[model samples]
Target: MSGSGTFAFTVHPRGRLREDLARAWRPLGLVPEAVYDAALRRLPLPPVTMATAQIGGERVGDVVLVPFGARHLLADVVGGRRRVGQAVDRAVALGADVVGLGALTATVTAGGMTLGERTDIGVTNGNAFTAAIVEDQIRLLLDRTAGGGSRPHIAIVGASGSVGSAVTRLLARDPAGARLTLIARTAPRLDALAADVADSVEVAVAHTIDAVADADLVVLLTASADTLLGPQHLAPGAVVLDATQPRNTSPDLRVQRPDVLIVDGGIVSVPSLRLRGGDIGLPDGRSYACFAETAILALTGHRGHFSLGNPTLERIDEIRARARELSHLGFRAAEPTSFGAPIALESRSAVIA
Candidate 1:
């Protein structure tokens, strides 16, 4: 495939109020779902445009957007897969070379395996990139914490999942020999993952939130659509990377613990494609790494499934190299943000003691 031949279609759940108002206004002819639907069918969303750049010295193209909203999850629960399928198909029709499932779409599609099988274009869960970014953020935290004579205690929430498993593997290679904690709903799977990493680092497993209580650095990648981490679960000076899009960090933390640093994992900025009128809960010039992975792959003319199943070290190195080569066009983590603004990590010596 030609490098410029790569295009992307992103399927997101429809916005709740938009969908509801569209339905309510249909009888009055004030809003027409069909017209909006036809427009999406004919053109990719505007603020969502093609990013022209080189990844690994190869050119690429991308299509970006906020698909539907959170209600789509409820629709899926009510057997509304057809609506989701329609959204996916629309992107495919718009010259998309591959379609990336973002946030809930990824989880709904069963890690992109089912979505790939169903869509005409290639599909990626984007978990591999998420895994990579989480690892990177963790390492940065470890370095900062170690400067103060505190050896970081690493914790992975949802450690049994594919993304979590990949994170465990990456951190095990840490030369500081940090203590590792794996938390998940299932003990058996946690035990299995722990065994896999036992040679690289000391490992412990817990089947509940309490597993995170003593961790100095926590990576939240749980599949649960609810808040899992709060002030009570963390130490005073903890560094957390909330990898889940809707956010795995609790709102209470913002009100209660200003001393902790929480960074949104997968945040990145794309060059040349300016976001105009969409709100995907990101700072200006920032995007999720999963979104960047698709854009990077497209830029490099790579049509294969770059991130799928359990990501390996080889996959991480390949993508990292591609990102570096495309440095001029690549994405970086947005500054540390919590509750819609930059977080100031205050000295917590009083609290720590």
Candidate 2:
């Protein structure tokens, strides 16, 4: 544990992504801000190092927040990369041994590979740990609902993406016998992924969301700016892991469909923290798994770009092993979170009953 060096994490104004961030602005409508964001996107802006925090205790390290917003990052890729790369350079200049890319900053840059190539410090999208935790929480949900009885039909949206592909590979390796359907916009990528996991589990491919509507368990990983899955697209008692940052399931579904279990995937427990609860969209003692991944790398001294494009099954397993080790040291996954808190299991049961 010699590598307790400072690290920086890139974040953007999540925009209308979460209800907490969109509250008062929600009444004003997303268009005005989106339009303003579009205007801001045109300006050449450098990544701002917004805040610095000292994470104390056994695994002490400093964490810096680098500014980038989903709206701006998605609107202009070339400009966004320039800004993010600038942020990384700043972190490196400021003595950060590693930097973690969050939200669109992690995804749009080829999962941190291209960005890492530009920096001497370590780079990671932090998707490996994310994929592991998502898969674990999905199994826990299934155990609670399905009770290990029958094999469930699982569908993964954005199956061709890094996190989706890793989740698909992990789930396929499970002996639970769940059938998988990979959904993505590209047919060739889906076919290739399905073929890769052909020996592990029963697999199929689809280029549309409709094919996954009937699935008992759905994992949403699409990088779409807007929500994709709605109440009409899921079956009763369906469990959804909305792994996408902006959330793949529309906010309306939380009220419209109490019968469904929608978990904000990739949340993990953090021991020491000095941030307001509402600021980060997480309750006390919890953080995003991607953030935790950076902490893990910094604490464990694993350097270089990690969990980049097309992360192999072996790499995912290796990260999962590290997570297990962290769990022993008091770092672990938090309770399944939905609508900004631990999901209401009683309500879920009432709907199921």
Candidate 3:
């Protein structure tokens, strides 16, 4: 990762056809599913050059958007892999020093292992900083909401996945007395993760979202394409950190449970960059943590594949350190955001009012 070189941040469609107007119009005969099928058959569509990013008043890198449609999530593993490779190929062709995989591109490729093998450029799944950011934000949220009083009970959904598991490990390593419950579809993995923790941290295992209903803070990292946590699954005044692509927390929950604070995980505020187009999906000064990881790596001149698979505790620590170094240069977490919009302080106050 050289400061003079450019990097590509690969982003995918959020695996929901309903969000795409072209695909969403199929039912009324306005458009046909065959059109979407043809698009899928095309496999990895041509890489779209998204935007050029400037960091600290200098041109640092450019962002690329890759559209690997929803079919990749619907039991098309081979197609998913091809789409990932195509995105990597485009980045490599564009002379990117490194490429950061966003959303399903990272997960479906098994933390970018297979894609990394296909390209010579550095690659990252972006989970390392995502975990670090989520952990730091959780502590900040607690301090604001709970006033640093007593230890809070925490629940991590999809605890077996890479991001979820990393979050669990980092939080467990903290000296605080917060209790944690690991929730996933499998019991064996949950049991194994719990056994890995130190004895001082109270930890348990559950296989359902219901287990989080009593938690004071919930971190949602599930890979499910649909929503899991609803109004009923949150306790009053509970804060949820949603790290998934399609988002584990539903928008309906905002109306159903206004008391619950649902913040989009891994959004950072960058002071240097000015965003132009609508491709990257962030407001004026905000960025996704995954993209920020790539920029930080490039800025710090870290050249190598990072955050692959389940990152080791040491690796997570190193990424956090680098991110902090960037923070000194004006790369820091932005104000809390939900669905790419600024979350107004009055909205939260209105809920309490």
The clash count of every prediction, one per candidate, is: 11, 1, 3
Least lDDT summed over 10 consecutive residues: which range in candidate 3? 344-353
| Better candidate number, 2 or 3, judged by lDDT | 3
Best by lDDT: 3
Tens-digit lDDT string for candidate 2 (1-353): 45456677777666553332342134423445555455455666555554454344442333333334566577778777777787788778777677887778877688987774654888888888888888887787677766455778889999999889888888888848788989999888889989988998999899989987789888888887777887888888888888788666776897998778887788887656544222355654677878777777777667777767767777777877776666644456677667665554442242321
Off by over 4 Å in 3: 1-4, 15-38, 41-44, 147-149, 275-278, 340-353
TM-score of 2: 0.87
lDDT of residue 70 for candidate 2: 69
Question: Is candidate 1 or 2 superior in TM-score?
Answer: 2
Worst 10 residues of 2 by lDDT: 17-26
Q: Indicate whether candidate 1 or candidate 2 has the larger lDDT.
A: 2
lDDT of 1 by residue, 1-353 (tens): 24444655453424333443332233423545565544444453432332333333443434444434444454443232443455556556666666666776666656665555653666676777777777777776666554555556888888988788888888887637688899998888889889988988988999888878878778888765557687888876777878876678865785688767676666765544443333344544566777777776666667756665567777877777777756776455555565556654433311211
**RMSD (Å) per prediction:** 6.4, 3.8, 3.9
